[model samples]
Structures are given as structure tokens and as C-alpha cells.
Target: MPEALERTVYVVGPRWHHHAAHADYAVAASLACQLSAQVKKLNSPIEYRWLSRALVRRLLTQSKGEPNYSLGTLLTEIVVARHMWRRGGSLYHLLYGERDRTLARSLPRLFTRPVIATFHSPPARLAHKGIDRRRLRGLEAVLVVAASQRRYFEEQGVTRVFVTMHGVDTQFFHPAPAPAAGPPRCIVVGGHLRDFETLGHTIRLIRERVRGLRTVILGAPTRWQQSLYSAGGGSVEFRYGISDHQLLAAYQASSLALLPYQDATASNALLESMACGLPVVTSDVGGVPEYTGSDGAILCPPRDPEVMAQAAVRVLDDPAYARERRVRGRTRSLQFDFSVAARQLLDVYATVLGDAGMASG
Candidate 1:
């Protein structure tokens, strides 16, 4: 067991957009390419399955009301367990908290390898399920993306943990050679608006606070989201379900971006928006403050429509300040670039391998 030899680190999770060129899937694929490690994205196929009905039903029954458990959820757990047992390597799962430790426990008992659980968000559901704090001991190290999530993991008694913030790909998200300069252009992105009042508030601001400003909302609509849009008086242009390139283009075209989530962990949209040379007006929730640093973006207390509106106008009206923020944000966004992220991830794998006495080069 040497420290210099490279060892396999598998990222097991529910299926991301492996078939399509989506950002989340692209992030996973890009990370794998950068690390030069084995990458298998397992998505639970809802329409078809090779598993027996009895097994599927039993799994569904056991995973009821639990986060990360659907037909896809069941398939992911089973497939990941089989993959780990069939061929040996260090197990690294990218998920929020230990909400689904049952999947982690499925690793082969005699393999004698460590499971590194990367916590992406606060365990909102684990607390709801009343899962005991002691169960997290199954993981060897908890890699956290935010301080808030780190505190939650510490409360869960997962002492062997480290904080490694999420990174973005600057090269892909770089600002266009030139940004459009004209009337105020605002871009609002992400989903599930009803769950978060930010959308309604943002629309209200567009209607009242900043009149004559062009606003565009991106992503497909959920039923609840439609209700939120209706509540906003239906004046804003809503572009439902667009490609990743379209979203990036919208960010580049707009004067400012709005990421007003109710309870955010780390928003991919916000990061991508900043990387595209637009200053983000986001809620000071989850890992946002960590990503924006001090100079790049505007942070407001969540759930306040007036404050959100005022902040949006401030960025849109002040050209000098807005340009400065965009430059600073774009610069900071480089830290999360895939190349940098892959190298840091490899370091984590090396640390885990060294601890486990596996060969690493």
C-alpha cells in the first residue's frame, strides 16, 4: 500500500443526465474525465427495470417518505452495492448528509475499505425521519461543501470529516468576449418556486420596483410553480425547460441574475451565472456566502420582497459597481473550475487511500 499510486474512486449516485449534455451530468462527466478515474452514473429507470417486481416493491415499501428513494432510488442502491462488491475500490458517494446510509451499508463486509460520504446540503429529511445520530459512524470521512452542512454533520456524530467546497468550470462559463450593454436585463433561474417565495417576490419587484426592465425565468415548471407564476400576475416571460447552453446564454445576455431560493445549499445556477460575467442577487442561504466571497455578489435576507427588489435595482442601476461585481465574481468562479475541482478531489482520494493504506500514485 503506497501513497503515490493512483487508485479508483467511484462516484455512485442516482442517474444524472449521462445521456444528454446537461450541466449536472456534464459536471459529473467532466469531473470523471479530469480525475481520469472510473465513472458510472446509475439512474433508476422508472419505465423499465430488469429487477423482479417483488424485490422492487419490497425496496419501495422500505424507502417510503424518505429522500433519495424512488424506482431510481432503489435501482441506484442495488446497482451501487453490486458494483462495489464485484470490484474493489474506495467508495465515494456525493449526497447530502447521511440521509441514505442504508445504501452505504450495502458495501461488501470483508472489503475493508472506507466510505467517504460527501455532504452536499443540510440533512433536512434525516432530521425529519428521526434517524439516530450514531448511524453516521459508518462513514470514514464526511466531505462537506458548506459550513452549515459541516455543523449538521458534526451534530450527527460523524467526527472524521473535512470541508471541501464545491468548484465550478471557469473555462466553460467564462464571460462572452463582450457583454450586451443596454436597458436593464434580468435573468431568474432554477425550479420549484412555490416552495420558495423568492420567485413571486422577484416578479413583484419587476412589476413595481423596477419598471420597464426585461425579466426572464428559466427551467421547466412544476404544478406548484405554475401557481406561483399566476400569483405574480403573469407578466414576466417564462421560458420553460431550456438547454444548458440557453441558460448560460441568458446569463450572459442579462444585466443581472436572480437566485432567490428559500432554502439553498449550493446553487449550480448561481455559480454558473457568476461565471458568465453577471452579478448575482441571491439570498444569503446555505453555501452562497462561501462562493460569492465579499465583492462579487449582493446578498439579502431571505423572504423579504422589498429588500430583494431594492437590491436588484441597486445592481441594475449602478453601472460601475455592477461591472466591478461581475469581474470579481467571474474571477472567484474560477476556483470551482472542473480542472481545479478534479485535482482537489484527487487529493481527497489520496488522503483516504493513505488512511486506508491503499496504493496511491
Candidate 2:
């Protein structure tokens, strides 16, 4: 194949929302834009074309829905795969694996070109969602956010699985010039796969130990979460749908980030908090250690509120310890910068295409 042809790739995923007015941290989660920017920076021959949202909407209106899958998403995958089968490319990369199983199952009949996907869900969640080998039959590579996820895909016979780092915009989420003046504040962001019972208990415990403690919960929580975490609340504030600047301000203002997770692959909230120079007290489960390592953040066993509370209180009480963690976390976050992730992903593309020299220049 010609080098130009080999460098051409198509990316299919969720509709991207660009926040040009705000910092990168304010932008919603999606790699399509970041990947494009990095490829340009490398000055590589790679050409990426993302499917338009308008096309996706049109397809959704014309297609029937599938059980347990979004009608628009299912139709988009089928249509995109069919289009790629007719029109040749070096590879087809699905940005989200959960949305691509139908495409994977149908790819073998449509074409023989290599197809790769990135899977974000943890093993347990994937298994619960019925993501078996059959649904993932035609994928040439499965890129996961954590090494821990490799076993589940490998056990299901995915021979070419790779761990890809989840990237963060370090420039936008940098530490504050000076700590905010007020009572000690602990910020809890996001509600996905979070152990709210543990969080609630930990908050109660921390409040008793630390004087003038304030807890801020970010993101839109469910009724269950709101009711559970808000009960017997003392200085707990819940903020929903705030702008990116406000979100960044919350992280900068907080003394520490308290993230109690039931399970995780990679957490945006964890990464962003660390990038903002806030020390973390997170659960030691599924890829959390991989991101934080030994010294970057304090880790507690899952569902253990006492340990979680103790870690948070320690950060709040000890200035020297908090500074050490703050510096270490900021340094750790640089390794997972968007540029690094982009380079790694391009290497994955090269491997799948069997072009050893690709992206080397």
C-alpha cells in the first residue's frame, strides 16, 4: 500500500463539543480533538477524518433500535463500518469500544481491513454488559485505559490488547499560585462507580476530626446519591453543570480531593484533581494505583470509610505532608499528558498497520 494510503485513518465516536472560550479542562471528555492536534504537532503523514454528528442523526432517524443499545449509535456503527468496507483505509479506529461491538461483529463480513477500539469500562462492568468475544469478533486490537483490564479481554481470546494511558490537559489544570483562604475544603468530583456509602461515612468521620471542614461535591448526582450524601450534611455543597472555569476554581480552592470509588479503570476527576495540585485520597481498586503509583496519592481499601477519612484528615492537618503530595501529584500527571497519550496511540496505529517505520519520523 502507498504510504499516504497507509497513513489515512477514520475515527468514529461521540459528537465532540469544543469549548473554545474556556480552558481545555472545561471541555468534555473526548480524544478526537486532542489526537488530531497531536498528529499535526508530530507532522506525521497520518490523516484522520471523524464522522459528523449530522450524519449520525440522519442514520439514527432511518434505522431501527437495538436492545440494550442506543438506536443512533447502533446505526452509526453499522453505517460507518459498511462505508469503510466499501472505501478502503489503513485502519478504522473506534474511540469508544462499548459503542463499537455491533461494528466489530459485522466487520468480518464487510471488510478485511484492520479495526481497533478503545475500551474504558472496567472488567466487571464489561462482563455485566455482556461484552463477550462474539461481540468483539472482528477487532484487530483492543486498547484499554488500564493494564488490569487486559486479563478480561485476553481471557475472552483478544490476542492483541494494549493499555493506553488516559490523558489530561496539564496546562489548564495546574496548581493554584497560593492556597485559598478559608476553612479546609475537600472536593469530591463525579459520581460514576463511586462508593457513596463510603463517601458519606468518610465525610461524617472527617468532620468529627477536622475543625471548620467543608466538602464540595461536583457533577449531577442521582436522586439516590443526593439523598445519601446530603443526609446529616454539615457544610456540604453540591454544584451541578458549572462552567469549566468554575470547575477548575473548585479544584484550585480545595485543599484535597476525596475520591471513593467502588471500581475504576481511569478517572478524569482523579487525574484533574492531581493536575490541579490537590492531594488525593482514593480507593485502591482497578487501575487507581497505576495512575497514582506509591507517592502521588493516598490509597485506601474500597468501601473503607475510616481509612479514607483518616487519609483526608492527615492531608488537611499536615502542611508538609500535603505539600509533598501536591508536588508529587503534579509531577505524576505530566507523564499522562495528552501529547504522550497521542504519541502512544499513534504507535498503536503503526503496529496494527504492520508499518514499522510509521510515525517514526
Q: How far off is model 1, as Cα RMSD?
A: 3.9
lDDT of the candidates, in the order given:
0.64, 0.74
lDDT of 2 by residue, 167-187 (tens): 788888899998766899989
Measured by lDDT, the strongest candidate is: 2
lDDT of 2: 0.74
Top candidate, metric TM-score: 2
lDDT tens digits, residue span 1-361, model 1? 2123366666655424421133342364356544464433433344445778998788799768565556765666666665566766554554533445565544534355567666564557446545446556567677776677766777777776776666665766779777666767777776732224665756666666665677777763654456556645655567875776776677788888877766655567777888888988888766778888776678888777678778788887788888888898898787767665555555666677777776444
TM-score of candidate 1 relative to the true fold: 0.83
Q: Which stretches of candidate 2 lie over 4 Å from their true place?
A: 1-5, 15-68, 225-232, 355-361
For residue 5, give model 1's deviation from the true position in Å: 4.1
Off by over 4 Å in 1: 1-5, 14-22, 25-33, 37-50, 65-68, 92-100, 108-112, 123-126, 129-135, 192-198, 220-234, 359-361
What's the lDDT of the predicted structure labeled candidate 1?
Answer: 0.64
Q: For model 2, what is the error of residue 267's alpha carbon versus the real structure, in angstroms, after optimal superposition?
A: 0.6
